[model samples]
Target: MEQVVNMGFISIIPSLLAIALAFATRNTVVSLGFACILGTFLAGQGIMGFPTLIKTSLGTTSFAWVMLLNTFIAILVAFFQKTGAIQGFSQYIQNKNLSRRAVQLLAWLLGMFVYFSDSFSPLFVGTTMRSISDKARVSREKLSYIADSGAAPVSVLVPITGWAAYLSGLAVGIGAIVTQEDAMKLFIKAVPFNFYALITVIFVGLISGGIIKDFGPMKKAEDRAIKEGKVLRDGADPLIGKELTEMEAYPGIQQRVFLNFILPVIMIMTIAIGTYIKLKSAKTMEAFLFVMIFMGISMFIQGIPFKEIMHTMTDGVKGAVPAIMILALAYSINSLSKQMGTANYIISISEGFLSPQLLPAIIFLIASVMAFATGTSWGTFAICMPIALPLAFSFTGGEATTLVVACFAAVAGGGVFGDHCSPLSDTTILASTGSAADHIDHVKTQLPYALICGGMALAAYLIIGFTSI
Candidate 1:
């Protein structure tokens, strides 16, 4: 059994500090790092706790895998940009002569299609559509919001994606789910109750279709783009960086944008789904690896020198260093949360207050706060599922399966809600980077919509909780 720290209310300090600092500073890495250091110190390891923190963080296999996956994604995006594939894709979209609303809808549709991995979906869709959206007078902020809305939300809704695989494993590990097959069934049943994700996706479609008018900062961004003919606000610093912004396609090759762009994307989708079916698990990293290899080979065949390809790859990795640092710190804080017994403390305190009619709504709210602070939906799942599943089992007397499913949905939906709104989230960062929007701008413009969906989800959970009871 895992040891629980007896720090009482102090256990929540790290997460609270992290969230407060992130909002105040708009620097996720610094905020998470400081919180991690403070948490380590409070764990009674003294000043030397910093070294132990780094070692523990680096020692985690998931951290390394996430690092590699993010780096590979950056490299693939760089390759696409360098080889003119992304430009070609943009040109193809431009040739369609679609109106602004149609163009935004197209980007939304593209995001939906790339649902196998949340990380890949935003990067692929945002990069491919950024120029097109700009041409159609769509704000970079709106583009980013569209990209992000389709990412984690879509992945969690789909059962074949990496999110589902990880979530199913967590369910099984908690012992509430008896088998992988049963876990998947439970996940599928809960999908309809994932109100935040469902509503977010639908809301994106409504916004793109002009049915839902923009409000808050998003409205200002859209007005700036359309009225002033500026895709970005004046003085906005886009997250694409100078290096990637200035990268040019290789010389002396006819840019067959359609063939170059579509082929690799198709291959990625095929490998992701094919491998999942064959292996009974999603091979997200392996899919990305193979896609990178295929992209390199294709570039080489197109007369781009191997050295140039390698340079682009290196540049891509370098560009992703900032995001990687943030992710590393986020992971470190999650580890600290585990050691500090943050989730346990929260659960223990809430146990006395939980009732069947309020359990789902309460769980959703707590999971949302935890994920928002940590900037990791998976980490929230890891923390919440163990407590939630067993409590759900007890609350329902192991007979109210639908109520249990509703609670599961609340947790999953809440995680996505928090992740969608957090500037510290990896997918949120990728959406901004891929769309060439300012990171804070992305966070600011997207938050209102996320909050709206989150509120609706919370209310839905309450209704479901009451109905089930």
Candidate 2:
């Protein structure tokens, strides 16, 4: 009877509502906002007391924390751009005179270099490598594809990164079922199974620089770039792009582009190294915070003056306005959904959908669906971990290392796939806007590739499940 009640409550209405908002408005913030409201409603009042939902649902920590973090990250990224550090770095890469293929390969190589500093990976790589990819006529979607793919996957796969440490903590929290060392080992094993990320790296190399058929919308974008002999889309020069244009004129300006570029790189590296060494650990939030501070300092020293620093931060905040709101909304939905017992409700309804022999496949499907619906890899992991890990751990007779690894891989792949397709995703929009490609074009071109990778991962999961069991 209790199980039945939990099942009815856990159907995930809050998540559904969030998904609806995202699609309806085609805005990530709006989708998240609606989801948060739904979560608050669930938490503050029973489903029956719909009228008082708004008044009661005002307090939730998830909404607040996610907003704060988003605000900070956005501001830092914007300030880095305003300081001309990005341009300096891009110019340096272009100066190398590498062929387009060489440029694409270099971008992949650099992503590996910065894998230890997860938060800095996207910004740092995007800041520097996008320039060369642009010059070589790689589409913005492809460049972003490379950047996003490498950032989190590489960070998490390596135990040395902040992400690895974060997962370790999650493992510890799950308690008794798996040790920290075991969790780390499982995480390492899962990397080879992360089909989306590994394949993305390979696809970037093949599709860019004319190695394979660019048959979809991506091919069109590529063709246009080549004919024009430029990286930006027609009428969309990188220098004049809105994000880049806002900070072109500033103080402490380095005439030597190389100096402008190298300084930021050195500063970011210094912060990451310093934090890891000073703390004798890799997982502090301070590591993230310190990197932001160093990034800001480097920009200021490069030529952005104190006055501009304030503006840069403000600009950063403005960029994050949408992302912060969406994050809050996402958290709200989770709070409400869990409060209402929505996840349990769904599990009950779907109980026995997979036989005990097929438990691994069912777990993967659940993780993927949740991730795709929520548009967050971390959220998917957090929610599923509490339920899936415990159940799998119990089912496997306390040896769930392999199952945990599979589940983690599923969520990771699903999240990236969602981000690739989610028109409301911040990274998706940024990739389009950054690369001077049309927003829809990036989505359309990348969707096929993401799907392909996802399929491969699923097949891999099945193979591993059957063999390991």
Candidate 3:
């Protein structure tokens, strides 16, 4: 075990520096890297600690799995684009000639359907629907909002997903839930109470279906798109470059758009779920790997040159490299924080305020703040779960499952809530890239909606906290 530093309040500096730098510079990699270095120094590791930092950051089995899963998904997305599968599907939708409202609704629906991975969902749905949504006069901001909201929120609610696997593992690790089965059961039970996720998902439909009128920046974006025919505001810097935003189907090839796109996705879901059921665990990474292999084979069979295919896959991997770097840095910071006892320090500071009637609300709010600052829901889960779960067990005297469930729900929901709004979040960035929206524009437009849902979720948690007690 790594030695834990007894740094008390000083331990928070690394995280605070990271958060401040991220907000100030809008560069996650730089902020996280600086923070990691500072944290290692503070932990009494000498300058040579850089080697230890790298090893600790990427050496773990869990981290490797996450990296592979994300990288493979990126490759798969590249394959989809290269095969003209995404474009073909977009054309099919265009041929249907659905109304603007219907196109928006379809984009929203596709987001929910692609609930396997949060990062993959937005990249797929946002990129696939960008042209269609643009034609409908939907602002890139709005498209990104729909994509971002749909990604994490839906992933958290669904059981057969990487989010569920990670959450379930955390729950079991807490030892409050003895078995993975029971931990997953608790996760499922908590799903209904994941108000932020549930509300965010429903809110997307409300906005898309025109049941809820736009109230803030989103309204202005929609208006600009409709009246001025500006999909992006004048001089806005979009996250995606022209090469990707304007990528065309490779010329002179038979494009079986559906076959190219749908088959691999279907295979991924089918095989992932089947393998999980057989092995009594989630095979998310394995499933993605299989899908990538299948996609490569299918493309070769379809007469796409091996060289061009390799080039496209490389481009796709390149596209995902930014996100992967963010993930690595996020993980490194989390590790450093752990070594410095940041979570424990925070828990200690807050422990005096804990009460059964207020635990859920407090946990929710804290987790939300942590995730918002860090821009990593998974990291928030890693930090908060160990702290929150034990507190719930002790506070409830180990008997009130309802309270435990509520607290669990709060942590999970809060992470998603913060992730939805955080500009530094991978999913948020992917949404902007996928929709060809300016990163800050996407953040600005989505904040109001996320806050609204977060408010509702906060109210619900308070009610559950007080009433259940």
Candidate 4:
């Protein structure tokens, strides 16, 4: 066991400061940076600890993967813009005169189909649907909400996903979860209990299908888009730079639907899904690299000059710079979170009032707070599972009962709720970038709906807890 650092109440200051600053300034990078500095100083590393923190935090293989992924996806988004694929596709959809409801539902379905990778889903769906959604007068806020809804929430609920395997792997050796097979059974059983993910997906479907009328800030955004035909509100700073979004198609180049957009996306889906099935890990970044190459070559053959292709690629990289910087600092803050024992601090505060009837509810809330603070659901699982599962066992007399699975579901759903709301989360950032929505605007609009689902999930957990007792 790693020795626990006892900073007591002070350990939570960094996360609170980072989140508060992010909301207040609407500038994620600066907020994360300042919070990181504060966290380093408090960790007894003094002023110099900041650099060491960055060096270690951004140095990981995972961080490198995310940075590269963002760059590659940005390049593809730029290529799509430059080739006029999105615009051309929107034109076709316009000719079809698809209703706003149809367009929103289409975006939701597209997001659902791209379930192989959470990172790939939002970017592809956002880039594909942004023009179409705008044409239908769908708010950028609403589009982003659909894109964000489909990523982690959808990914975590599917039983065959990497999410399921990783979560199952986490339960090993706890009570009756003695092996991978044992853990898998328990995880599968807990899927129906993942209320937040289930309800979130359902909510998207209802709203997109126009079954549920828009409410809260989203209703305001939708009203503006409908009444004023402004997909984005006035003065909104979209996460994606206009360099990509506003990049005009090269002159005199024919925009072939198959070559410019559809084929390259097909290639991405094939490569990503094919590899996940055969190799057990999705080669998502490699898929992006290959598609980008295919797209560049295809565009070169389509009469777009070699120089223009190169220029668009450069612009693509530039457009992703802001998101990349935010991600880098987000990683740093998460690292700082670990070193300062933020999750541990939250857990310590909540672990005292335990009973069988309340275990599921409290565990869910703790996992929610932990993931919300750290902005990573997988990280939340890694920390919460070992502690939470064992504690549940103590109450259940070492049995993997319905109460145990309920606890499992609580952790999974709770992590997702927090992940959805946090600005520092990668999926939320990716959603904003994908839909070309303002970063803070996406959060402001999506939080009310996420909280609704979360509240319902909490009520369900409490009901289950009381009945199981």
Candidate 5:
């Protein structure tokens, strides 16, 4: 055990070094790839040669799950887009004669709902809502902020998502550390305490309602937009100007666009409710089937030819390939960390910090840090479960709920926190890309909101930890 742990810790050195290098150089893809390679090398060690390591590193269940999830999401997105659903949604928002605040609120709700449907929350929500947000004259920063706020955080809150299921499975594997059931229960409790996610929702409400004025760079951008009667920045809504041109030349496609907009949503909601009530144990496959069915229904309703739907599905899957590659690489790195005992090393470090009054806070802090570092809350939970769960059992004196909630909250909140900021994180990239906002701009503008939420979450953890009742 000691040897495995030592080797595991040693193996992480390359990844750590690579991340530092990436940050220093500001090369996102290179930095991520280097980290992934380092992880694979450390995992392979001597048991497998470089070729085997490379193959297995990219061939894990985590990688497979990404492919499956992305394929489904891409298909659904494409179906909606090709059928003109997105245009329809945008039209409805514009035609409603609603206030900008109302549009922002609706954007927030859409963001939350999209988070539940796919891990690609940023792309799903941003792509669908960009047109609407633009029409409302909401700044791209605010749109990205709303999308980022709800994306991963909401996923962490839900138990039936890819994020939740993945983390729960990880929790179950750590010898007697934590059970899948216990891990999930903890996640549920932590949802309320997740200050970052909660604060994000609040921030949107406040900002949209004019209770909070834009400030700093965001303020400048908004001012420029209002004064110039247009966005002054080059990075403003990458998709907007381009799509407007296309829609103008092809006005016929815009005619029944609203129907396309409503179809995918109705389908996804029905599936979400069905999965929640009937197939409680549904996995990625169940979700895929549900989404596919809805797309089919959409085709029939929209009078889209079957061949056209199939073609769109193919195109959607193609678009998802890049994200799939990134996800696969990420999963491979995580799996390698597990096999190399890096996870156990993490657990070992966390074990010494355990205490009764501080246990929940510790869980929150530790899980958040680990999730942020690893870019996977589920990975963080998997690593901590073996360590924290058993400690919780031994130290809680019987307040399992407290321990469970703390652990769950830490993992869920931390995962969202990490994914929110990580340069290499899929959601971060997708949000920017989908919104046609520069990736760095999106990251920079939206980070404060995430940090604010993180602060609130920390306070909530302390409150939950200290105040009995």
Candidate 6:
């Protein structure tokens, strides 16, 4: 194990291998599986480490929480389809005859409004806006980009979200942020300097508003949709299977169709927001569970039989299989990354690059690369904050300078760049499933836009660093 730790370049092989295979083959499961196996072997474990690693990775309470949440959201999507609620809502929006720009704008707004949870925001907005966007001739790639732009980027912008809480908790005892309140204040102070999140969000809005035109792979998808009227590309494999995407409305389900959709959403926002305000930690899963319970009872009372309800739930679970399989492999590889001390190796190699005038930009670049390779923004935040904050303090002689705040925001925003674009990011996967877009296509189309924003953010961080001196 020590030998593995000392093997600096070896730590990154698995993640890099995953990235290369994913792009070359366009198969997430195969890419992730091979990376997991290679990573396990590299960590000094034999072939038997594969199963053991899977058990340890997926056995965590965190993985269970994500698994159930993904399943529940899928089930809710199934129920929405089965009851014709989603259709009714889409028809209602389409009946207004909103233009494509307006429809995209609406989706962007929906994503921003669901600012409480990164996990919830993209999926909810994607599911809630997919049909309407399709009817407006918007490509699924565009929809995924909008959904993703508003996810981790938006979550980190707001103060009450789980992202904020986790970040603030990490910041505690660092520099001037000794208390939770102090950490929160520091987070807020860093918000405006969080250049990537700000730019990414604004870019989405501008694109949606028709102030900016589509470019890169996204433009190709949009062109295919506009000229051919194909919302998804021909032969694209969507993460959400036809089981839920094509699920028919249950027989004898007729009345209050729109209400069926609205009530549960209301319940989720109410409970999740309410708990976060009162309890600091957001009970996001509980909110989804309550919505499910309400939907089950409400649908039953709406004259759908109990057997049909159970059957719809079953179909929902089945539809979750494709996404879950990919996610399981993703988790396994991420676990291997942790065991190999991949992020630590990154930090170690980055040590020589830190200086006051260049620190902010360098930190942002390092965080971005680490998050991209590992596919987890929060993991980057967790590892980077402890090091970045202490470095910022030492560089500033413990005075709260512009450099310190800029560094803080650099890590926050840079990590989100990975979440927005990386194939292995959960938010990216959720965006695909929610929009029923091909996962690889989503990654491909969104990558250019994310990189543009990342480039702008990097420039801004550089300015902040030089000017702060």
lDDT of 4 by residue, 1-469 (tens): 9698657777878888998998898787788999999888888999799999999999999899989999999999889878888778878888998999999999999988988778888888898899889878999999999999999889888766778878999999999799989998998899899999999999999999999999999999999999999998998888887788888888877878778888888898888778877887778899999999999998888888899899999999998888888888888888888888888888888867888899988989998988888888889999889988998888789998889999999999999899999988899999999898988899999999999999999999999999986
Rank by lDDT, descending?
4, 6, 1, 3, 5, 2
Model 5, 23-82: lDDT tens digits are 565444556667766565555565344346558766666556656766776666666666
TM for every model, in the order presented, reads 0.93, 0.75, 0.87, 0.96, 0.78, 0.97
Better of 3 and 5 by lDDT: 3
Tens digit of per-residue lDDT, candidate 1, span 63-109: 88878887888888788789887788788778889999999899899
lDDT of 4: 0.89
Candidate 6: stretches off by over 4 Å = 1-6, 255-258
RMSD versus native structure for model 4: 1.6
Question: TM-score for model 1?
Answer: 0.93
Worst ten-residue run, lDDT, model 4?
A: 4-13
Question: Candidate 5: how large is its RMSD?
Answer: 4.7
For candidate 1, list the clashing residue pairs, or say none.
none
Give me the runs in candidate 5 sitting further than 4 Å from their true place. 1-4, 7-27, 38-54, 118-120, 137-141, 158-191, 215-254, 257-259, 283-311, 339-341, 350-352, 401-404, 466-469
Better of 5 and 6 by TM-score: 6
lDDT of 2 by residue, 23-60 (tens): 44545455566556555555555454433443343355
| Candidate 5: Cα lDDT at 138 | 70
lDDT per residue, candidate 3, 57-170, as tens digits?
789986787667667766776787777887788788889989878988888998998787786788778878988888889999999999888899999998877788888889
Give the per-residue lDDT digits (tens) of candidate 6, residues 203-265: 999999989999888899999999999999887888887888788887667846547898888
All candidates in order of TM-score, best leading: 6, 4, 1, 3, 5, 2
Backbone clash pairs for candidate 5 read 85-260, 85-261, 88-257, 88-258, 196-453, 238-436
TM-score of 6: 0.97
- Winner on TM-score (1 vs 2): 1
Clashes of each: 0, 15, 0, 0, 6, 0
